[model samples]
Target: MSGNIRSSLRGQRGMSYWSLIFYISGFALIILFASKLAPGYVDAMHVENGLKDLAEKGNIRDMNRGEIVRDLQTYFMLNNVRGEPTKSVQVIRGAEGMLVSIDYELRQPLIHNIDVVMKFNKQLNTAKPELCCEPLVDLEQYRKRD
Candidate 1:
């Protein structure tokens, strides 16, 4: 009776070889998907942050549509953003401020004949400055005085 009990315990010690292989394969697939998709998400975040930064500069309300597009292109270049330039940035003037919008897409190859595509849209409202006030002293002048 004791030998029979020990034999049963040994058989239940751990997962079977086939079960371990299945679990490892599933985890590998998840990691592969994440590695392929993470860069696109990161780039989208960078684009969003760049739009916010431009809005915070408090000059978008004064720039024309063309100027806004040029500014966005420059920002993308500065930040090393990767994607095709299909749609340009849109700048709409409003009663209280300007609305800047960026719409774009990214495509990456996953496996044979398979690709991952992502689309993103980011917008921001930049208010016009109420007053144009110069600093009390120029930085160059202040440095010379010091």
Candidate 2:
């Protein structure tokens, strides 16, 4: 019984240094990726919350398109959101009600030559997913800041 136990113990080796290094490296990469990805997601959440808050104010229908954009710009500035509200915000007036869309993409650099792109589109009316990289709204003249 002692001889059998000794043979089994010899074959059952603990984790090798190389395996441990590989696992540690993988964990490090995951942490690095998460760190790089976090800012974009956080900014998106802020933008979405801003839209929700604006919609819940119960005065969006009375406001004109430019006014809506102006309000969102102020919110974005106050919140320090990096995405351009002028390019992202859309005011669509429908027969039923108003549909406001805040469609934007956030790109953050990860490892060299690698980037993470997070596309966020939130509407007052359950925003639908759309293709990114296209100008959803063009308010360049308003680019002249107030």
Candidate 3:
């Protein structure tokens, strides 16, 4: 009976040292990933917010393409965002307003030979009178050919 009680207590023992190490290592890995990946996400959010603010200001509609690009550069500078402005920022004249868009990708190395790739594509419309650069597709054209 004494041997049986000792065996039951041993069987119900708490986590072993190895198990504690395994759990702690997993938590540490999660923290490492978050530390490496969070900044990129935060910067992307800043870019998105900056674009939205620009759209809300309705100044992009009044500016020419070059001026718009310059303004975007300034915004990026003020927001401490790092990216190729000429490639990322695009201004297109849509039917109802000016469309400003940013398309870019960020790559971050996590561990040995492992990496994270984040692609961000954000656009906003500034309501202003402008000639549509890309012609709107006529809805009638999509009608089923009889």
The residue-by-residue lDDT of candidate 2 on 19-138, one tens digit each, is 999999999999999998887777777777777767666666688889887888888888887655447777776675666777667777888999887777666642322222223444
Runs of candidate 1 with Cα error greater than 4 angstroms are 1-4, 85-87, 94-96, 127-146
**lDDT score, residue 45, model 1?**
71
Each model's TM-score? Answer: 0.69, 0.73, 0.73
Question: Which ranges in model 2 have alpha carbons more than 4 Å from their true place?
Answer: 11-13, 84-86, 126-146
Off by over 4 Å in 3: 1-8, 84-87, 128-146
lDDT of 2 at 109: 89
Q: List the residue pairs that clash in candidate 2.
A: none
Q: After superposition, how far is residue 29 of candidate 3 from its true place, in Å?
A: 1.2
Residues 1-146, model 3: lDDT tens digits = 99999999999999999999999999999999999989888777777767666665645667777887787688778878785433677666667766666766778899999999987666665663232222233322323532
Winner by lDDT between candidate 3 and candidate 2: 2
Worst 10 residues of 2 by lDDT: 126-135
